[model samples]
Target: MRTSWSPAALDAALENVHRAGMPGLFAEVREGDRVWRGAAGVADTATGRPVTADMRHRVGSVTKTFTAAAVLRQVESGRIDLDAPIGRYLPELVPGERGDAITVRMLVNHTSGLAEYLPYAYPSLKAFPDLANTGPQSLEDHRFTRFDPVELIGMGVTAPAVGTPGGTPGVYSNTNYLLLGRLLERVTGTTAEECITRDVIERAGLRDTGFPTGPYVEGPHSLLYEAWFGMIDPPRDHSVQDMSWVGPTASLISTVADLNRFYGMLLAGEIVGPSSLAQMRRTVPVVSQEGKLIDYGLGLYPMEAPPGRDVFWGHGGTVWGGGTLAAIRADGKRRMAVAVNMQRWNRLDSAGRPRARPLDDALAAFHRVAMYG
Candidate 1:
């Protein structure tokens, strides 16, 4: 049931998250014409600079939604076919029979069976499918490294297939999205970043969202801290890093307000035509990078809610240290976007599984109040 929400409730929840472990947190929540924004804790732990409700964040993976929309826009223009094999367009990248087997639709929904290149790209993380015990060496080494998308794609493509083409329970991989970015560039005859910025970000009228052109965020932003499941005792800051490793797949910088606005426009059918939006919302079961089953669409996913609560649709993103989540209610009447400064709080168990920490519960509590109220 929908209940009345006081500003105090939201503020308290946010503070709870900070007190739990986050170095900083900021969020925006809108219900109908009423909007609430809250911030708690510091943007810089060393200086104790306060975080604000409006600040740029490296919202990893959320870039996929924009990329997916751009491709769907191409679909609207009849320049691309959803069911067409990717090999048909970029055969040189995904050559041979394997390319013919993976469809654009499969890539969008992550059913293409491509393994994540993260392990291969960051050799220190090769110990996966269990990342809980992984060290931070690879991330540290590549902080300033500029990775070519093709080289990264090759790592994932040549890696053993995690699943079959068009398979169910598909594995979540950044490789699929990197390939999508290439597809966008192939069809648009321009950079993927430019196409998304012009077609999706600008079209949504989001002033604070864009692909980062440099190693640093240009505006007011918090320092992103990475804990690496407590491997780094003080949680090293990773706010300034060359984002080329993920490229168009996870390197977009944005704010909570911009995220809310972008998702609101997207769900309202203002960014893409209704047919394209429909295709973007078609979900398939996929194993997330977190090792949980999620209903993933093109670039969007359904936020699991209680039986009686309204379902929210959008996406969650995490870079090395920063994390973000933005969603609009299924009815498009309510929306929430949240950003946090620290990541990898869960401790690893003997089995190499992540054990939930207090911060996880605290963040969920804030989300319940932010989105459901």
Candidate 2:
């Protein structure tokens, strides 16, 4: 909260960003004791709410860190086995064919061969469920957003298989994490929100961080705009869909400050001990990069590696109108995460042209300041 950011410079960079269809951008950077924060453009263009470090953002894939951490807690407590077939924990979720072959380790590594049935996204608001389930108070919660994990798995099962039955070396599937959530629920006898808050959020005393629900729409919310009905209008609000769509794989909403606390604690072994951290950071190799292959650790991307090797170790995720990427340094020292509500107000790209991936430019611009500079 003490670092000085070049506000004028960030604002100017974002102006061109808006022209490119990016809605809202916010970021934080930490190197040793120095911390830099930036917020460019309006969070809710229609409502004219200026972006701030405290505003909550839907950190699409970064949510994986939370889930992975929670699971490691279970492992630390001896509540679950990392190498056992996930079906051992939740038999009902086990696919008849390859269920026993898929292990918790595979799920974390995205090697479970379960092709993404829905990209862990809304596919559009119409597909979101009405909802049923309890949630922590910090978040307007939804446990069952539309279809339960069972139903979604059924849909995934009916579709063509991705890799061979057993997701071996390299297959990224959100379904694995969905099953992981179910497994966590079975092992802990609690919902993901309960575990996430108890093990991490609440423990860290994160105030403004949580999954927003109905009441969220009425308060200091970032207005999300989407070009609806093919109109070149302002972004539309996304308060309608339940936060559950984020799934265990990637649905987390938090302030820049809360994210800082979470990652900081993570590295300090506040939430988990050293052994559990190792379990979560372990990487598995994959070979699908055209003429290359690489390793993806639990909840993280590649960083740097051998030929066709990818050592990028961050987690990247996109959902509905939200996108995010977060990761710690190779040594798990310096950590960075970004969140923004890509609420589309105008259907056009600030010039009557249709928009695609509206927040792309904002993401790039914010990273330039927080990561590069």
Candidate 3:
């Protein structure tokens, strides 16, 4: 028997999100044919506009799932080879023995061991935590910078590899996906965004999702705020900024309803053949910097639910201030997408350890409600 989803319970969970210091939170849950969407707090803190279920937000790294799916579509068409070395397609871009050693499979599963470029490109955010909030010049200077994917990959490859290619205990790197995006372009003779939209978004029938060509979110959306943790007098509005730095790795704009639909179709094998989906679900251990272990699949993360709840398969994404979690049950009978308009609440303490934060609690609560309800 399915547990009854309580609107009151969901509302309370969202209130906890707001109480945890986010400006707003929105979510959508689906079980069988039933759907539930809820919103809490203000979309714009200054105007007090309410967040709605339809509002678009930067779904961030969750875009990897779409990118991976698109690449897999090419795999099904014989246009790409999952086991082939990335160097085969983009010899000029990848270059050297490292490139030859890194296979498409390694990139998709984040086993390529490529170091992330963001910390190196935006060093201020990594070096000085205070600058993240104190109106650091680097933040503003780089916010609108249009970084080429090649340059970003250069930044990553130049850094030390996290481990050998196809190594165990995969280290998550945005750089791997950035290269995959470039690989898609090389193979399809189209922009990565175009390929993803045509092959994944369009195929999934996601009318509300698209790759934004500019910094601004079109249509209805909430104000995205980056909470710098008192570096500035108040949290900065980062809703507008070019996302090219991250490219297909984290630049997709979508709504909760669209996210749910995409995952639903994906988990049901409508986007790829059963064999490709099996490849996508191939498991690897992803160890966090803090030593937490999460079982990561090719494009998805299989999140173990709390006791008595079903396991969830999907991905979570975070941009400057916005955060999103999208998942479907193992049986594909239920799915959910949760969005919060604030980011960086999971701050590190003086010892460089993550401090206990309420946003974590809010997420856990929402997951329980989404699963059991």
The model with the greatest lDDT is 1
Q: Show pairs that collide, candidate 3.
A: 133-231, 133-232, 134-231
Q: After superposing candidate 2, which stretches have Cα over 4 Å from the reference? A: 1-16, 119-145, 165-169, 213-219, 227-235, 285-295, 302-313, 331-333, 343-362
Instruction: Tell me the number of clashing residue pairs for each predicted model.
Output: 0, 25, 3
Give a tens-digit lDDT track for model 1, residues 198-220.
99999988888888877899999
Top-down TM-score ranking: 1, 3, 2
What C-alpha lDDT, on a 0 to 100 scale, does residue 329 get in candidate 3? 90
User: Where does model 1 exceed 4 Å of error?
Assistant: 1-3
Residue-level lDDT tens digits of model 2 in 1-373: 2223464655565455656656666666666666656666677666676877566766666777778888888888898888888767776766554678877887777777766655223332221121112111211123235546666665554556666644457766667677778888888888876787788778788886665543243335465544442332444455455655445666666767677777777767788897876666677765432213666666655544334322324665555455566655554445566656663332334433434554555456655544433
Residues 296-339, model 3: lDDT tens digits: 88889888766776788999898887889999998898888999
Off by over 4 Å in 3: 127-136, 288-291
lDDT of 1 at 344: 84
On lDDT, the stronger of 1 and 2 is: 1
Candidate with maximal TM-score = 1
Of candidates 3 and 2, the better by TM-score: 3
